[model samples]
Target: MINAKKLEEIAKQVSESLPPSVKQFAEDMEGKTKQILQSKLSQLDMVSREEFDVQTRVLMRTREKLVDLEQKVAALEASINQQQPESNE
Candidate 1:
């Protein structure tokens, strides 16, 4: 989610851009702009930086476990193949 402070700063900038005649409504405009920004931002599909980092770590661990299992399976298959030839002789 976007930070509240950053949203407020954006709203202030927008309100300040209005003509002098609208300056009387600057406060109102600022509040409305902030609400609109928050509403639109919330509608987007997004994740925080921390959440993204945590998911990346989880994926790395899962890949490591997968690789270890593959190596163990290959070793077991090789051992079985060797035993099969000896048993047939």
Candidate 2:
């Protein structure tokens, strides 16, 4: 989700940019702008930096486990092959 404080700051900046004639409506405009910004941002698929980093760490751990499992399987196969008798026997 987008940060509410940042969204409010952006809305305030927009409101402050209006002409004197529209100054009376600045508060209302700020509220509307905040709603619009939040709605639009929610529609998009996004993740916070922290969330992304957590997922990255999970992927790294999973990859490491996969490599370890592969090596173990290879060793087991080699051992099984060694224990089997020759077909000519």
Candidate 3:
């Protein structure tokens, strides 16, 4: 999908006119441009849908476990308070 050389070839084959100054290298420059552009764009941080989905699933599972642990802690605290021996000096 990230092929500059193929793109430049296609551009030249599609273009009917080329300036004399660059007629000989129209294809080469176009290919080079395509590569540069693709490289730059790739360097930018971009996430795929699949990766995002996987991360989301991981987060959901973590949240569920956290909630369960919190509930257990609260129940234990309540039981401790109820059974605490009162100070009767």
Candidate 4:
């Protein structure tokens, strides 16, 4: 989740950009802007940076294990092939 201070800062900046005539409603604008921003952001499907990093590490480990298993299977196939010719002789 985004930090509340950052959201407040963003809302303040947005409200400050209004014309002079709208200055009277600056506080109200800021609050509404913050509420809208939070609501929209929450509706998005997203993950935090930490969770993304953890999932990336897990994927890397799984790939490494898959590669290792593939090599073992290849070596076993080669051993079986080598013994087959001798059994035929």
- The most accurate candidate by TM-score is 4
lDDT of each: 0.93, 0.94, 0.90, 0.92
- TM per prediction: 0.54, 0.55, 0.53, 0.59
Candidate 1: tens digits of C-alpha lDDT, residues 1-89 = 88999999999998878898788676689999999999999999999999999999999999999999999999999999888756554
The better-scoring model by TM-score among 1 and 4 is 4
lDDT of 4 by residue, 22-48 (tens): 885766899999999999999999999
- Candidate 3 total steric clashes: 0
Q: Top model by lDDT, which number?
A: 2
For model 1, name the residue pairs that clash. Answer: none
Order of quality (TM-score): 4, 2, 1, 3
Q: Per-residue lDDT for 54 in model 2?
A: 100
What tens-digit string does per-residue lDDT give for candidate 3 at 1-89?
Answer: 77999999888876756666676687789999999999999999989999999999999999999999999999999999889997799
Q: 3 or 4: which has the higher TM-score? A: 4
The better-scoring model by TM-score among 1 and 3 is 1
TM-score for candidate 3 = 0.53
**lDDT, residue 81, model 3:** 89
Candidate 3 stretches with Cα past 4 Å from truth are 1-37
